[model samples]
Target chain A: MNEHVKPVELRKAFRLVNHGPTVLLSARNGSVDNVMAVAWCCGLDIDPPKLTVVVDTIAHTRSLIESSGVFVVQVPTVAQLELTREVGSRTLYKEPDKLRNSGVSICEMAGHDLPFVEGCSAWLACRLISEPHIQDAYDLFIAEVIAAWADDRVFRDGHWHFETAGPEWRSLHHVAGGHFYAIGEAFPADSNGG
Target chain B: MNEHVKPVELRKAFRLVNHGPTVLLSARNGSVDNVMAVAWCCGLDIDPPKLTVVVDTIAHTRSLIESSGVFVVQVPTVAQLELTREVGSRTLYKEPDKLRNSGVSICEMAGHDLPFVEGCSAWLACRLISEPHIQDAYDLFIAEVIAAWADDRVFRDGHWHFETAGPEWRSLHHVAGGHFYAIGEAFPADSNGG
Candidate 1:
């Protein structure tokens, strides 16, 4: 594990995805591992942290998640724009070298057998909750976050330091085909309000 | 109706919220109307657009949505940060004057009776797709967009022009407590990859 990768409290895990950045979902089935980008990931619950993600039926990574019953949701950075687009566009079923072609390297954390992308700002190890109906009808999957991690330089003390961190470390919010806006300008709301 | 609020094509409605900005959800039941800010609203599908939102059991807005089976999801801007915090923090059940105290003014469209929050960048009128199981167990609601609109200044021609619009028009992404990061720095990914 990278030295800057630190554990995030499960209660505070919702904050990792609360802002709605596009995320990388990676899973392994037997000796094969696959990765894909998802823009529909959302925070579902706070305690016993849960999140919702929409994985299309055609996505190869979706099958890996189903077979393993586990997957990793990692927050990719602005620096990974090209990588994000590639993973989202290509499929592992046709091209077995999709990961290598997309310039993706897999890393691992102790005690967790899932594959974690090498250069993301945060990681959430999730166990699928298995809502078969929604999964069949809408391609929507729900999962409970068993553990979480983040790069301390960008996120620490249970909060994101985007205002202070380098712009390259910012999260990517996808708009349309190949277009994205990096997160910017952090400020506290007026004290008189919430 | 505001002159700038033009109807958005149903196929393109998902783009209005694909970036994951914190949104204002409004609904009316009988003579009662209520609004709340949600960070969990996410795009669920493309054609005949659909969305999912996690509305807690205690929310006054949730009850209104359940009774009416309709609601409006509007993308609040950086300029509405204070209003967003106030509405999310105050409750319509306990304080009858929540809307007025929170500085929320209700506006309307030609055919829809729902309360639309003024000064928002985009709006999507939705009819609830009630999934009782998820609502009871997860506080989650799914809906199909019935109609959509956006301020031409910020969103038009089937795309979001945040890069050219004034900073105030940028969407707000909530982090925690009163903290938020405004959408920023629009750029295109390398075309060769995707």
Candidate 2:
């Protein structure tokens, strides 16, 4: 049986992206859907939860995200690196269902229409807040995270419990040259109790 | 004796920030200087190495960085968490030389007047590329990295060698609540030798 998890409050959703993990951006319009890897994204606002992500103007996923105004950002674990690279390099125009083609399983949550990769540790459903200047000038898209969710085993009560969780629960951080560093060694805040 | 490292070409300087590490933003306007921790940053362009960072309107570092038209971004290692938090929490208004107050060592690099924090894994000297719209809308500043250097022991030849390097060489990733995750396991791109 699949474990159930709750959606994080919109105000607190920025915490998920604040850590700067490389995410798999998923978008769908009508029957067409696609997923691409992105390392260039940051939290833009807190309340209503705005985020900025750079999606290349020529990318196949950009149009789908622009048209649908809704997309999902999935934080994948180290074991999913192969799948992440596959989806990242291939476009939806070339591969209609890259998720399935990459041999990765997908499931749709009860409330959100977008698909989340099964192996991902956390997911966020975002709605675009179009800023044409940023998009045209820097390929940056600002969006509000309407809904957010995460695997309870890894994230609960707004804190990551990577220590108790298995290694597969750790998020991936991308370096250059196609190399990636798995999130490691959690140290609690000095001000806050560990 | 301090090591003399060659400056990275401006075009390839973006690679320094391509991997998401929380950076220490140091700035100075005449005699006044300050430093703050910022995780909301990313590479805006490749050639000429333009990057963007969000600094709150209320921050003292904002005015200093703006007036100076120059700032240094230092990528700290895992061991520097205490120092990073010290610089992050204390405002320049409270203690102008927070670096000295906090007991963290600082050094000047290249032609940049601002002091870069010592013991950081990497450093970038930048000149502000003023963009009013995004700055007003998002508290973001676009800057071009004028000079870049890395501790060869940790980062060399366009890649981070965290594995071979000691724990002190590991880069930091900030999670919410003052928590951080160190850069962990690395995987090479191809199975065959390049």
Candidate 3:
């Protein structure tokens, strides 16, 4: 296990992606590997901690996941904003050493062959749930998380502790083009006991 | 057309749900109607602006939507936090007037039979694309945006302008229980000539 990365409970894994952060999706097929930023991702189930993410049909990471049936999802923090945008803004079609170009370094994840980004706030090792129709038609992929991890400084007790962390710990929420929103403060709603 | 809500170009409609907010999914069948907060939603296509959302099979809104074959996707802002949480916490299985119970008021959209929340940041009147396999298995639904609307104060000229608007225009991204992170400041990332 990497010193900075800590394991997150599988059941609590959904909270990792729950706050709508733009994530780095990495997939390795044999020796070939690819990492790309995906803005459209969300938690689908709680106990098993399933997730749904839209991978562009033409993206290199999409083909890798399709071929290998596995991928890793990692949430990038505000400090890596430029790196996240760079990864998402370009295609890995014929580019070699794409990860280096995006300034992303991979760390070894236990029991997973995929290369997980070193500085991401959280990571999820996923086995793709095969749904060819949607994969072909909508570029939407669903996966069940088998392993999860989070940076202890930002996430503990199954909740995001962003208040104590500095601004760099904040998650990124992209709007369009190169513009992104840093996730703001967390608050609880007063429902008047509804 | 409602004075506050105006038409959004279909091509730019993806911006409505681009930042990954939990939105109100509303549907009507015969005289029965339902509204529920769904956190799992994202834009699938850009030109025609299609969307894929997960509506739990047991949800009343799901049944109404499946029967009617149409629905509305409305983005609730920070001002609607309690209402969003209230609507998501309860089910309309046997209870009557669920919308009123959640303190949400409805306004009609043109050419649609459904009611959209009056103060929402944006609205997308959708026609279901009808992919049954995934719908049955994943509780996922894909739809084409027949029409889109956005509150002028928050969204304009093909982008979200949350900076100028008050917190009422800030979109809600739910984490779990009653916790949510209001979308914060927007910034542009500099690319290294990729």
For candidate 2, what is the lDDT?
A: 0.78
The prediction achieving the highest lDDT against the true structure is 1
lDDT of 1 by residue, B39-95 (tens): 999999999899999999899999999999999999998888889898999999899
Report, for every candidate in turn, its global Cα lDDT versus the true structure.
0.92, 0.78, 0.84
lDDT of 3: 0.84
Pairs of residues at least 3 apart in sequence or in different chains that clash in candidate 1: none
By TM-score: ranked, best first: 1, 3, 2
What value does the lDDT take at residue A21 in candidate 3? 80
The DockQ of each candidate is 0.59, 0.51, 0.53
lDDT of 2 at B119: 81
What does the lDDT read for residue A100 in candidate 2?
A: 82
What CA RMSD would you report for each candidate?
Answer: 1.9, 2.8, 2.4
What is the fnat of model 1 with respect to the true interface contacts? 0.68
The weakest ten consecutive residues by lDDT in model 3 chain A span A185-194
After the best TM-score superposition of candidate 3, give how far the Cα of residue B190 lies from its true spot, in angstroms.
Answer: 5.0
Off by over 4 Å in 3: A189-194, B189-194
A79, model 1: CA deviation in Å?
0.7
Model 2: residues >4 Å from true position, as ranges? A191-194, B191-194
lDDT per residue for candidate 2 within B1-194, as digits (tens), equals: 05834466666777676767888998888877778889888877777677788899978989998788999888888778888877878887777677787657878764568877888877889898877888888887878888898888877887778889987667777777588877777767752111
lDDT, candidate 3, B26-85, per-residue tens: 998988778899888887888988988888878989888889899999998888888888
